[model samples]
Target: MEQIFGGGIIWTIFIGFIAGLLARALKPGNDKLSFLWTIVLGVGGALLAWFVGSTLGWYKPGEPAGFIASVVGAIVLLAIYAAMRKKK
Candidate 1:
């Protein structure tokens, strides 16, 4: 778990929160996410980026995703979330 997270759980949560804020700021449009949800989004994005990067050999084992990549991943997730919400 520590290897996957690239740090201890607390560190991951801190990074995730920061990434989430950046992602929300960079993405255009309104996102009705609470504080907790933002953290979840960021963490999820980081995981997503790590998985994709690993598959593409951009990241070796136990390597954490870059900040930019994390933000990008969050943006992609946010877009998907928005699209899904729009459909409802």
Candidate 2:
């Protein structure tokens, strides 16, 4: 954790929170999502963030790219969720 402690965890959490919120907002019938679902969106987005950062070189040896990548991933997921919902 110390490796990231220099500066990243907090931003990651914040981005996760925002990403979940955006996901919820973009989700069709998002009102039906429970609190647990929101947490999932945030955490899942955070996980995706790592991949995005590494793939795009946003993730330096020790940087705070997780937050932005997570947010972007969450937004993409939310858009997908919205599209799927639209099909229904």
Candidate 3:
């Protein structure tokens, strides 16, 4: 079981969108993202979650999270993105 690429890329992106939307909605804050950015964030976050989940084996193929997990994962990805951008 791997959180990073559970199920595959297609599934990852599909679930990533759902996760990202929930993540943003649940933890909406400052900083506005265009449509593209949100998708990127979502997809990236899902990939990140997959990798991270793989480390802990928290995510399994064909099964990610209900909601909370996705939010947490996306939040982490967003935070990491912000931090990296801040550095650049």
lDDT of 2 at 88: 97
Residues 1-88 of candidate 3 have per-residue lDDT tens digits of 2344356666666666777776677664664677667766776776565566756777665565444555677788777766787798
* Model 1: per-residue Cα lDDT over 1-88, one tens digit each: 4553578998888888888999999999989799999999998889889889999999998888887888889899999999999999
CA lDDT, every prediction? 0.88, 0.61, 0.65
TM-score (all chains, Cα) for each model:
0.93, 0.59, 0.60
Best of the candidates, TM-score: 1
Report the C-alpha displacement of residue 23, candidate 2, in angstroms. Answer: 4.2
Cα deviation at 16, candidate 2, in Å, is 3.8
Model 3's TM-score against the true structure: 0.60
TM-score of 1: 0.93
Score candidate 3 by lDDT: 0.65
RMSD of each: 1.2, 4.1, 4.0
